[model samples]
Target chain A: MGKRVGLEVTVAVAEAVALCRIDMAGVYPITPQSHIAEHLSNLVADGKLDAEFVTVESEHSAMSAVIGAAAAGARVYTATSSQGLMLMHELLPIASAMRLPITMAIANRAVSGPLNILNDHSDIMPQRDAGWIAVFAENGQEAVDLSIAAFKIAEHKDVMLPVSVNIDGFQLTHMVEPVIMPSQEEVDAFLPPFVPHATLHPSRPVTMGAFSMSDYFTEIMKAKDEAIKNSKKVILEVWDDWGRQFGRNYKPVETYLAEDADILMLTMGSMGETAKIAIDELRGKGVKAGLIKLRLWRPFPFAELAAVLKNAAQLIVTDRAVSFGGPGGPVFSEIKSALFAQANRPAIYNYIIGLGGRDVAVSDFVGMFETVRADKAKAKADTYEFWGVRE
Target chain B: MNIVENFDLFAPRLINKKELFSCGHRACSGCAEVLSVRLMCKALGDNTVVASATGCMEIVSSMFPTTAWRIPWIHVAFENAAAVASGVEAGLKALRKKGKIDDRYIKVVGMAGDGGTMDIGIQALSGAMERGHDMIYVCFDNEAYMNTGIQRSSGTPMGASTTTAPAGKASSGQKTWKKNMPEIMVAHEIPYVATVCPSYPLDFIRKFEKARSIEGPSYIHCFSVCPTGWRSPSETAVSMGRLAVETGVFPLFEVENGHYRMSADMPKKLKPLRSYFKPQGRFRHLTDAEIDAIQERVTAEFNKLTQKAKFL
Candidate 1:
């Protein structure tokens, strides 16, 4: 038997090691991502990781503990699923605004609108503007790689924003795979110890989290926005540095086979693999097409996406979420806005598919193309359609 | 740190500044919560930022554009002052770390009503504390949800008349005793937790100064005398607050690292609790039996505190 380690194993090991490299972690239990916390608890319990494992009261407490531990200049970490993420939703904005460089793993799942707990982007989608640096992982290896990368990007002097590493619930979180685990010394060499710019200490006292009046409230918000905006360059630099260390490169938007294609299919999370297969099959059939995987959701890759879409005749943007009453899915509207300033932007179409873990079959891709071809046939058709579901 | 150390020896000199509390705001004329705010402002000075929840203090201090806060102040929502403060703290730290802002250390304070602190806010407060954030959380316990009409909060004293705990027919209003929050805070084992009242202005100011000086989560429970909710003459607010402790109903104390100390240790053979209970219009309808029950409960709780302190 040829021994093999899957990508999922790599993700869990990478996260566990990163927490060790960073220092302490406090977490509570939640679905689709319980293994990360469990591994952490075992590490701390078994005397492997020298850190505090606080069995917090709830998910709210879990996030709270991270904030506390993180503020204390510890490289704090935690993991949760959709509902747990929502339970900590009110605190997310707080953590982000506070500029805590906490790295959390979120197993993307459908929010309970009508009793749903399956894989979807809805959970992380709602928290887009909560001022977090949100990153999506397509596979198990990327999950591990991106998680380590998240710590660097978040703790950057210019970008002291909380970062969330989201993987597809059950699809990626529960998948068993062999992974190449990095050694502690190499990881330490790569990720330096986190030194907090501001923290609570008994000796050097300073007040934090104070009230702001009309004269300064807007300025405070402006400062946060500016910091996050400037973080793009820092994020790219960190990615480059990580690639140098681990020999794996990450881009905000990954493009495949778009050189001379008339159509482009774009997506994020695990389903990007499915879209990649569909794109490959369509290309073999002599349909000029390409695939784009969006890795970063927040500090959205607007400039990059627009640049990639410059030569496209038509774009099929797949979203695993809904905006309820909006024109298209949430990602669809965002993509349109990203291209709004570009003069050479191509026509974009938003396609909602694979929601609630409904199988995104090959026919789904065919349906997506049919809609695009229909749009090409009619010059003035609407910009979006919900795939695999009736209007 | 040196300045924090120095301020303890001498009463902090107040820098001359414009009054933050506006004239036409909606607080009771003798409201201790507003007075505490004014005093805290004087001590914290203009360099500080204040965040308040939707309570008596927030309602009176801010109204969109018109605000009593001359210094930087924010009000995000109820039950999130601690979480919001954590954000502000992180923001300031990042700013300082990046050298974007000057190194003049600013103090952050979060004030909430009792309902906000003792109930809904506990989550955020626990978080801020667990994060070990350096900030002060002040709960102005008027003993009930005074802002949204006189409803019974967890802090509402037993046998008291609240709209939610009406004393008609079979019920005696407010069936349970006021939750001992200072003790609960002590359970968090935070560095500093104190109970204060504006009636004793110096004590209240000292408590604020102490809490602000502590590094970690320091809780200060201010006994706010709400004239509107308490059904008493507004002018008698200060006297009632004094009687609260004098009668051992609300003992002013500080618990630092589990060291329980009373603010003013009362006579062993104390005045009847009725003197404290009978005056308030809310307590006017409490029967002799109910009053006796409340008095016994209060006395036993007070005695328990003394016993713990004596042994410790």
Candidate 2:
């Protein structure tokens, strides 16, 4: 059994990465994500982690360096947030297309224009089509577990794709909580050493990142799409193995008092925990309110979501980022598309909450439920509103 | 200083005979850039990994399902080959230290064109050199962006007409002086920095071999001639490189540990710059006054370099 200690989520994540015994980490610091990079560099400097810590100049070079390290058959890791993640956007798809198993942590924050460094999903929303297996964490414990599992999942023989473990920027990354710090022996037993499918080596030469023309571009993209879609099986298997080993089990979509409830509120990231409090308060008041927390964002658990929201009459979907001039929020658009073909779909309402780290408290969750209930009669499935807007 | 003294016309036969960069690449018929790459690969031998930037060489050598590279190669993006080489070198070092991989001495090499090196890639290159990675970065300087149809780059010489900076009634083409990349690299205080042209194959091979022997970062700026982009005849590719050197437009020199050394037997007096410019259509639009001004600047720059070699 691992020791349970109170540590900041970012520190816990760095500790977990050290336990995984990565060969290299190319990191550049940004707001809210600097702690993870600092802790990792400190671990390398103290001789606690036997890895190369490359202090890259920018997030672009950070991503590029890791891609090269991974291509050289080294187990590599990196972390960034907000503008830094935006800077890394160019190389994200390249890493996926090349099928390099590079693990990264995204401290989700609001991107600039107003120049805010706060918790939001604005950072990761743009990267949805980058073809990475993205997972969200609700707390410190999940952050550590997901950071460690990300390496195993990415390095899996069948699923040779990069993975991003997203933790809400300052909300979860700075929050201190009791987390089980797994021992090196246990982590080693759980995750095996990486064996790359192809590497840049002189003995066996392979040309990677070749330019493709019209004749082969479509076929290559199709293969990449199939690879990410098929990786869900391995993700499930790894989660099951983790559950069997550790006492804590994880799910794609977790429910709280959800069974037999007619109205359910859906949330992702740390806000899901806050919504649970609202659910409990509503249940005490003799209301049938439940909570659905989405953990897996990519290779999205479509069937699992459909099964959970099957019998619900009303669903309040809250998103942290807005999609301008498009249909509501990015998540809201995807959720609507996921349930568009269903026979008995609920009246779904999307509320864009928490712009630039505005606090979404328990009362905010209750207020959303009330608004959905009052508008249930005339509500269309596609309607969305920004919650707590000044005007 | 005496690195190339023992080399002759037959000296290349004594070097590695293996051709790591295979044939059937789609470079133009008289492309000196590909020839420079081929000579570099031969000099480095088989124990090397090449990180290429997206440019003419990368596109021509690596088309999907058909690769001309017989050694390990990667082309990540346009501006990050040095950064990628740093990662490859660091990864190899860590793996060797941890006993995860063999401890063989495999050299990491980065290759990029002028646009990839002088313009978009300068930051990554400076970072890698400042970090002191044990790698070699070779800038195949074709002067302009030949792969994208002769766009103007920072390395484009003054009065050289490119597609983007065309000589016209209003403009004189490529008004700014060529960026001094080798000097910029020397400012980083890296151990080895050299300028090589394939017009002198033995000298080029010797510098590469010497760079391989160095235990730290080395920068080799290769002067490549682009006949198509320069509007010169195909057969003048090799002669063009010779003219570039003999006219002192692109001198062959080395900066080792802050000491500058010119290649042996440089001309006592450089040939006229017009002799170098007359064969190329890109510079045919240059007025006599423009050519005179360019000649004065080139002479002054060559003298300044020779003075550095003499004193430093």
Candidate 3:
């Protein structure tokens, strides 16, 4: 990693493309994602990757471009953020429902309200149902690594759903890191050419996304449901295979100091680093606290979450997006539902933190633990709170 | 209506127990949407998937988990029927190349109401046309947004009373004329474009068959008369639709590769527009001047269409 100094993040993204052996990259210009596209476009232009890079007008078109490319028997890729991601909001579910092995990178940002744009997970929370395998990365190294792994996982014969590699807006997207760039020869040896089980070839055409009357309605959804549920094993196999090749363990949810710990905090994206610090600090102060970094979101990692949280006395979830009119943030609701059937789950809390690029500091985590204790004692035990905003 | 053998039902071409658009819908008596759907299914057969938008037809057929479609079907959100169909078409195209699917039987078709077609879905519709995917789009024009209530849409004809375009002192009903969606679609210069009425089943089926046979983008602006939306009895949903064509209010025509052909030749002895509008409460408030204006406009439009079709 140290020997690979003085390299640009854009080059790292291109190296990811080679590692994944992306067939078609459909992209539009929006912050952060543009560099990935630009580099890929240059590579395709120079005939390095031997792939198709379609430059679309909008994110809506970007996603549609990939939909077309993917359906046409291509391992499709794309990248967008914020407004661009929102523009593609409508097509996301269509991609998943149609079951295309499409992979995309989301340079996460806050949605526009007062016209502010910066790094956050708010751009992606509202789109949980779009049926993509969504994962958050803490650094550029993970972005490069996950992008390669995503192609393998999404293109797995059992799982034909889309996958998204999420990185914080400018934080990880533009940040320089010691990314282990694998050569194209090594990548070719590692990842095989994408052989789509269902393509839109004229020689033999089959109807997809057909009109399903009452008879096959449940079955159609059941197919997707089963695909997503069964994707767990494929995810594990891909992760293990990738880790073996790349020498990094990117589990669904990795535990830190949780073997004998209590009061565990669950986090995702770049915020995991902050939560890790809070865990170390609390342990230093003799508090039996730990951290769980949620590397995978879609396919929810429910079993792993339950196994980690069932023993803990108190569980806390920190989310970057504010899901209005609901029970706090998006993570809170999903966590509750995942544990709903579990026998006597622990006292859990949902906290909205780092919204609209607001910093989620170490003191905020410390304050959150104290608030959890005080609120539970006072019998005013709400399941969630905002970390950075005023009441 | 007795069941007759040797009816030449196109059911042989369809896969056994494989109906793309399943029946058992609560379509109003003589609802033209039902007939149009049946004919379209015959043309598309088991090789196509339909993206039906939210409307009277979708409500009666697809209610949550239950659907009136036997083939691979989907109902993404409203106003996205075209966009989703575009995605479906692209996805199927990619998968087939990947050796994941079979041949070209998997065409994409989007079914939408007038509101979904002429207005809310226009952008998506245009985008699909511009993209040039091999697909068929059927705009079932019922004149109003019936699923929501009898509300005026861009396809609502002049002098028709809607909830919003009511017959009042301030307005003589829908003062604006129906937008020419077929012409708009033709402007996309797609491979095929047609206008068909459900009253003539053979002609409607033939038009759809032609649209489906072509390879690129095609659109069918089907005249789907809605008795509920038109403020008329359910029994008149079909006859009223036929009257619309006979009165020159709606023309049965097809335009392909920039050539126009009137599917139904206008008879020399034509019924007046009054016969078409008089039975419905929608156009009841037309004054002598308003009626004259509508009559004149219809005559002119009919003549223009006849000229184009005759020339072709």
What DockQ does every candidate get? 0.11, 0.82, 0.13
Candidate 1 accuracy as TM-score: 0.75
Point out the higher-scoring one by DockQ: 2 or 3.
2
Better of 1 and 3 by TM-score: 3
Please tell me what DockQ candidate 2 reaches.
0.82
Q: Which ten-residue region of model 3 chain B has the weakest summed lDDT?
A: B1-10
Off by over 4 Å in 2: A378-380, B1-12
Candidate 2: residue A342 lDDT (0-100):
97
Cα displacement (angstroms), candidate 3, residue B192, comes to 3.6
Per-residue lDDT of candidate 1, residues B1-312 (tens digit): 223224335444533245644466667777877877787776565556566676777766665445576666665567867765565565455445545456777666777999999888887777677667677888888999998899999999998899999889888899887888887777888899988887776677777778777777888888888878888888888778878877788887888888887765344556788887766889989989888888888889989888777755
The true-versus-predicted C-alpha distance at residue A90 of model 2, in Å, is 0.6
Candidate 1 lDDT over residue span A219-305, tens digit each: 878888888888889989999998888788999998889877788888898888877788788878888878888998888888888
Distance from true location, Cα of A334 in model 1, Å: 0.8
True contacts kept of each: 0.01, 0.70, 0.13
